[model samples]
Target: MASVNRFIQFNNETINTKMLHQMEMLAGALADAPYLKVTTRQLIEFRPSESSVSVSVFWRHRPKQIERNGYLSDIYLLGAGYWRHFSIRAWTKFKKASTELPNLKEQLLLCAEEFRLIEKISKERPGTADAFSVRESIYRDYHRDRYKQNKQKGFLADAFLNAAFLQLRGEEVPGSDGFKPLFFLWSGIFDAKSTRDCAIVVENMLPRLEYMLEEDMVHSYYTFGEAVENIPPFRYHEGIESEQRDQEEEIETIEEWFQSWHRETEISEAPAMEFELERGDSSYAEGGREEEGTGEIQQTAKGDSRGDHQEDNDAADRQTEKAAKQASGKFGSANNQVVYTEKRIQVQQDQRGNIEDWRRKQAPYVRALLRELKKRMTQRRQDVRHNLNAGRLSRNLLPLVIEERPKPFYRKTAPSKELDAVFCLLIDGSASMIDKLDETKQAVLLFHDVLRGLNVPHDIVMFYEDAYEASDAAQPNYFEWMHKLEDGNRDHAQEIVSMEAHEDNRDGFAIRWMTDRVNKRTEKHRFMLVFSDGEPSAYNYAENGVIDTANAVSEAKKQGIEVLHLFLSSEPTTEEQAAFYRMMYGNKSVSADSLEHFVEQTLRLLKRTLHLVIQSG
Candidate 1:
């Protein structure tokens, strides 16, 4: 099936994942919380206990500049304002006290406390004024619009809340005369330096406003504290008591320490097993000890069969130990403790027939692409030098001879220089690719056929992890080689067709693994193309996978390997998805909307890359 590429326009502002990552980092730095993770959620929240912050996705419909400013302001508000200055314990108590109040007054109390925290932080950090200014403007406009709508809809409580927000921001309220006493009471919140003060002001104003406002507000403009209701009042005391118990348990007497050390020494010195050496026919003894003078054990007689057999076993044991150590060497980020194995596909005869059938079906498209690539390569390889003084003689020089300037010799350099490059194709074999597997195989087949046609030494491997069996101690990833560089130009179409969808994809680990292999190649140009349907998903890897993959891509580039990503999807690629892929692969990513588009993109990428290689050569 052919894939169609469609262009669509979206009205809402989309968040760029790369930019979001940067913002998260910035938030972490500003908040002095290095591990803080910022994400987009339905509501804006600040969870200091969890070291995370969430900005609302509701800002997506805002203008691009406003959305960016709003996000930045929210980060500053929660990170710098709330994290450092807001008193969680005090806010928790105030929230508990307000449990019986109407939602409008409760929301107003939270909003007032937030404004006080913002004011405190802004005063301390003068540079945050611009972002706060944008924030203030956005809220003022929002509340003003909502106030008129609420009044028209006969929601007096909501309208009063909105009007109170406008009044606090120093904006004129439509019915300020009627709420003069409430406004006078709300003015005390501006002078509040603490959450308790803000809570008190809301408490005082509620007595007068509660009677006029019959219903609670429909929307919650702010959340003062998240998940604080379940906290025990004596939690701090309990923590101290636990620490005291731990300290008491850690103390030991000198005799006890000595006993522990003695036990460790006894364990280290358990016992040793010795093997007796065999002797020849004329040997004095088979198990000779070391002599006192020479301090050397007697050597076994030459050609002792048992000695040779023992030596062979010892050598095999050493080799096995060395192989095990090498296999255990780690890859990817330090947190990713994964070990991978490489295996050659064991293709069956029936699979070979399927491979041939698939190849036959894709031959026309392959031939067309092959012809185009060959033509481009031929054009690139043509070395033409004009107006040279030496080399091939030109007839135009005869005309210049009359003027005594005969320098029109042209040179045509040899066009047989082969491309000095190598390539690797990494296919994601996760179960999510089941629907796209057929097209993925076609693309791989195209990649294999084209590279083989060019006589380019390349490798094609499908990588996946055993999600069910993965763990922190040892995650087993497998690389099933369809074609390997060591195999030269051997036909592996059958092996390529044997690829099956597996459990999960750990893209960063796979990329780093392949980068290590390709980096060792002697080729002047090394290119690695990765095909995956979505972000990395593996045991304990979802959160850090995207960043780790991006770092892996960067590391490959630093090692002179160009990593390009092809995002395979069964539907049209969304702007958000494209941005996410771009975050990992930078501009080297291409999101294909269909199977045909996948093949087309793969060919286009190869052609473009090869053209550059040819030109560079």
Candidate 2:
């Protein structure tokens, strides 16, 4: 059981996780990058390399709707505004031009460009004006307070930047009559349309402003082109002038930008060993037919119309192949570049004896659950027919048969239908499971035994990441198969007992990998049961891991595969833990406190899920 204070802390963490997930979805949708993640850091910026956006951590304390929307607006500005319109080349050029300027001046130039992007967003998305308005209101108040503090500390450079911010937003800066002329001169930034235009405006006003503000700002508050230089050069299609082509180019560039960011991270690390996984063929081509008179016009004119058609088909095929490769790359990242090592647990004589001993100890509970499941399945297959023309004759129906039709037979049973379902049981082998491993294995044994008795094809595997050897380039994950679908009714009690705690677990990646396998099954009903102790934890995958796992669960559900989570804990589950589980598994999650509870909950989930499968079938 958790203490009251600990419960409160868990509650807060759950809330933060939910909030982070919501923000991630919002940013990903706006940026049109579904894999994009959102997190809170010290500063607000878009990290294309990580495929993530960060909001300032300060916003976590402000719970008001205005503040919330203001931060949401910040996401929009970065995800949509900067991600879509702001060119990396232009940003790089601006950085080069500002290298020799004072820190204050450089910050002002960055601020100008930010406002220009914000203005563009307002014009394009009028509905977002209210959020941006809230943002402006918050920044004005923040700068005003900072201005007073900087002035009192005799930091003229910092105070001037604050004053300039206020003046740019049309707010008056007090006791700065001498600097009013410079503020007016810098106010032209509002009229600037492009980043270059903003830079020119800043450059023209910097000479006189530099003379007045001799001391450079003591602190740097602005971030311009934080990692833009790391991005690769944009590849533009020559002589592409159509609006649709331009839009396509922009979308492609944004995807490339994200890829480049990941590439940069990969380059910073040592070369990793490559692992391969089977992927499905592409279902559809991404883009439409190329323009008729593009570069291929001369070649097409040299050939007959039939040859031209064949050439077009060839081009489409190439495009589809390229799209498939791109999709495979994306899927690899989703797996966190894990090199999966599938091990078949080999039990020694002593281990086999121990496995049999444990199975004997758990035999009673397994039998009880198995009996209950069999009884329910029998009842589901039982049929009661009220009236029939043939089969068993009913004496009570004879009277009615004389006055009406001659229906005198009834049936008491129907043919039993075999279940058309498949099951996948994924166990978390993280170090935190050391204490609960015994109970978890017992519950898993029950699950396997009952499913095997019912003749259902199921798989059981334990997954974990090797934390000590994990790196940015490669994370080695192991999938220890206790029981495989091909194993049929073979009992693998020894393999189940062989399970031990490993280093860490990447829940999202593991879930997705299992989901892919389950998806390939031909069963009409599919189910994935995930067993874990707590939230996901892996290298560079704490908060994002939760969101990613939640997304994975949702994706599995969308694919018509039922996903249920069993949270195994040594102590009683608090309301906080339940809420946290709900975020990842929706309503299909159960937390077990004791050994008996673990087995009981697993039995109940299986019963309920199988009942649905029977009913639907």
Candidate 3:
């Protein structure tokens, strides 16, 4: 087997390469890295580039004992236009990976002793078959907003990070087979290393950059098959339907009405499915008008217990159900078997025409949809109690009366029920972390598991508003739905992320979309969570809206909804950081000394904010 070697090379024109300082930093800082990958490996390569003088950036973040936290592949895709030179720094592992020259081995030990910490010293980063996956979430100094900073700065950081990330990998991310690189780029910024000056700036900085910086911050979410344009288009002085938009999608500019018709269809390689056939367990609460007056409705199995869960059989059942209902309506037949109901006709007219055809076309999608609907119903139940206490809802709901038989009438006093806590997950479909959707998915999985474990009632609603690729939404019984989609395969979600959840997605739009509907919807013990990098633009960012969000919190507080906010920073360059604190928490939020200790930083913040809200409730 070939020895897994490492090395570094510099282009011929290496000038002010910060080489010595870089090597110095890598050596001493190995143990203090952001990730553990760096601390274990060394470097090897061909002739060292005088232009790009290098010292292996190695690290050793071995825990006293190595234990694995669930492994999920994270990929970062750079948005367009944004770019910078040497501004992006490396975590110790990347620094070591960059300097892979075998000849420099002896020199490395001698040249940088300050960096030579507890890890003795090694001639080469030794490994035979595999050291680390090529497509790991190589840590670059992430000081951007979603990770660390705010919108504008985050965009700048994203451009610089993308350039740096691509340069390190030395190529485009792989797709068909192995792994891919996920750049933590963004919406407002879009230019990477695009110009001659851009490359000159970068080339002038690094002695041995492996991947070439292609361009600067041009909005990647918009270009699709073309060049990434500038973000907001509003700021670029262009509307969503500017001249550059494909004429067909030009009609998508209408903010409130972008069609996600292909939402399920686009989730996979398969075609569309009939809604009824796919509506596995009609879990929607059979209450109110939607489910009224059916003489003791019999329950169908949420799913068949038999292991051979055939998509075809599910399809047949749906068809048979509809037909039987339709025939009963038209021919006054018995309530059994297929004959074509109003629902059946509609299902047949859909892309799947025949119930069987639809199932064949979209088996997995149908199941996922059914799962999402069930979650929504579960969440709504939690709100009923909270709304009544707040006086926003009719507290005098006369007891569940069996028509006039129970004869239950509204009493003089208000009645209340123990409202279930409604969990509303506002999924950020922004383009910042496009490739590393596994992180997002992992986040959803983690939060859902934690809540469900506690038997907390909640709902998952996906949000995205990227005009170019369009947008989509969903609410699902997360545990079952995510597991089904993953098929227990957790690694590749980053690669298959939906296009709509890219750089162009807007947070303001997502928040408003959820809130507009939420205003009318009822959920007591309500909690609405916003998960995003906080990159909403001037047009999208509404003070009134944030005020509206605050009011929602106030309303939730009144109803004891227990509103909470969890801001996940993707970069470290927040403008004031306090701004998010003041807005999300009451003003005066930035007591956070530094978030370098990410786990502590976020966890503490979430606990503090949540505690405050609960106390307010």
Candidate 4:
């Protein structure tokens, strides 16, 4: 018997990397796509809320933890295979729209979208179909168990979701008396007997599932409003007192008034579902849409098992509308007022002394680097005789070639390469960086000095968000440029040394800001390097900081900019810490254990950067 001894310690636990890698291979095969190109940020672990391993835009990779806890082969592929279809732009739009909907509705729509995408992607990628089938079954079983536990909450939502899931798997669902009456009464249209029927109804309700981001303005209330309008009214006994009947009548009158008040202002028709079965098309449809008005009752039900028709749905609609408005209003102003202003600061006298001292200490390494770079830049020209061939007479040496054998002629041209490059160094100036400020300054000094020696045009910017002053009206994001791209010298060396800790760090915004500057540069090579002691941390950004930063990095890559992260820290001892850094930086991140090792790590990074640039060039 072989021993399962391969392990890596993370957060004080031993994890089996071998097993985790095996799972990755299995996932890649099951996905029928190329291996997801494992990045440090990809963490596979057990989430009780998730039946199988899944990757959400919210997923942060925890490699060590996943290595320790082996996962079921099939369940792990559920998420891995699904994530294969994720695209940055498409995902951002999907996420934003999902946030606008109710929690239950959002989950339902997300599941439907996933099923649709997986089904489509699986057709060309062999094993994906099997994996998708397994995922659907697991999802159905999990939801069924959850519904069983909460049976008293009513199964209308569950049934709607279940039917779609089953239909997605090409299975039929038996008719249910309990949910049939409620669904028909609520929709005033479809009485779904099979899973396919329910799927058609759900797709019609959320037609913007595939193109949510493309919509000009997301009207979240329309779908729920239509659903509410058909909900059967609750009834009272025929022998009820006159006073009670009057009270009910008055409530109904108010409900009618509220609905009418908002109806004219709200969007009435949801954009129709545009189904296309082509593989590369911008559609999520795997099949044709049901004909309009088919199986629809068209008449609203007046009574149901809950007794007299009640105006409860009206209240629900009102609440949904209010919540949507509040959410929209909060970000509207902030989005409108996104302003970026840059300022230059002179190096302080005290900081100049420190900069001079560091410059002297780094003189030898700087000289060596400068000499190598200059040597590479210099080109020597060689002359060669032309118009001569081994089998023919040479024009210039025709007499010698005629007497002996002919020599081939060659031509030489001096090809000089100027290192056309632009560099943007983004420094994290958050409160958490207070302890690491001195080390950060030293590293920035080294970076500035090295580039200065090579005459490379670069910018150094420190970014932070003022949390206390942040609001819907204005978000106070600061970018203090120690060295502008055009600064071009060690003149602002003091400013680099003067960098201090600020409030909070919004990494994604900062990266994007720097990326824009680099994008405008004419340099053939561009690099945006981030220096941060921790993951993105800011007011209201804790939950999404990692994902947002990852997306920002991805965006930069798409624009032909090389984005890298220098994870500045004393030491990262936990898997969570490692995962967080990887999540933000992907594989293009480096770490320094302490201030003492900063120089060594920086040197290694510089060497690697130069090699990549030269190789690619």
Q: Which has the greatest lDDT?
A: 2
Q: lDDT per prediction? A: 0.70, 0.72, 0.30, 0.52
* Local accuracy of candidate 4 as per-residue lDDT tens digits, 556-617: 89899988888777764355556556655668887887777777677777767865665444
lDDT of 1 by residue, 1-617 (tens): 11112245453333455657677788878766555667677667754333357876756777878778888878877777666556555655655654334687667876786688678878888887887788888888888898889889988778878888888888888665777888888999878987678878888877677677666777777654346442212213444765565442221221222233334333322211111123222223443444423323323333434322534433433333221111223354323356566666556567766677877977887788668767766766675777777877786756575756566778765544566899999999888888888789888888998888888899899888888877665677788778777666777787788888988888888888889899788999899999999888777776566666776787789999999999999888977778777878999999898777877888788888977876666
The TM-score between candidate 4 and the true structure equals 0.52
* Candidate number that wins on lDDT, 1 or 3: 1
Estimate, for each residue in 1-617, the C-alpha lDDT of model 3 and write its tens digit. 00001123231111111222233234223323211111111221111010011122222232311111001110001100011111112111223443323222212221121112101111122221021232122333222222233234444323444433433434342221111222221110123322222223323233322232222333221111111121122222255656645433221211101112212222321211233335432433343243434333333444535344435443544444432221111111010111211111111123223323423433453344335434444444343333222334344455334334332232222223222344556655555545434445445544444344334455455543333432222111000011121111222122112213433333333443344434454544455565554534222222222333333344344544344444555445354443543454343233323233222333343344333323333
C-alpha RMSD by candidate, in order: 12.3, 12.0, 25.9, 21.7
- Model 2 segments more than 4 A misplaced: 1-39, 64-68, 87-90, 97-101, 218-221, 232-334, 352-361, 384-416, 594-596
| TM-score computed on alpha carbons, candidate 2 | 0.75
Per-residue lDDT over 207-255 for candidate 2, one digit per residue giving the tens place of the 0 to 100 score: 8776776678897767542465455444446776666455532323344
TM-score of 1: 0.64
Indicate whether candidate 3 or candidate 4 has the larger TM-score. 4
Give the better candidate number (1 or 3) by TM-score.
1
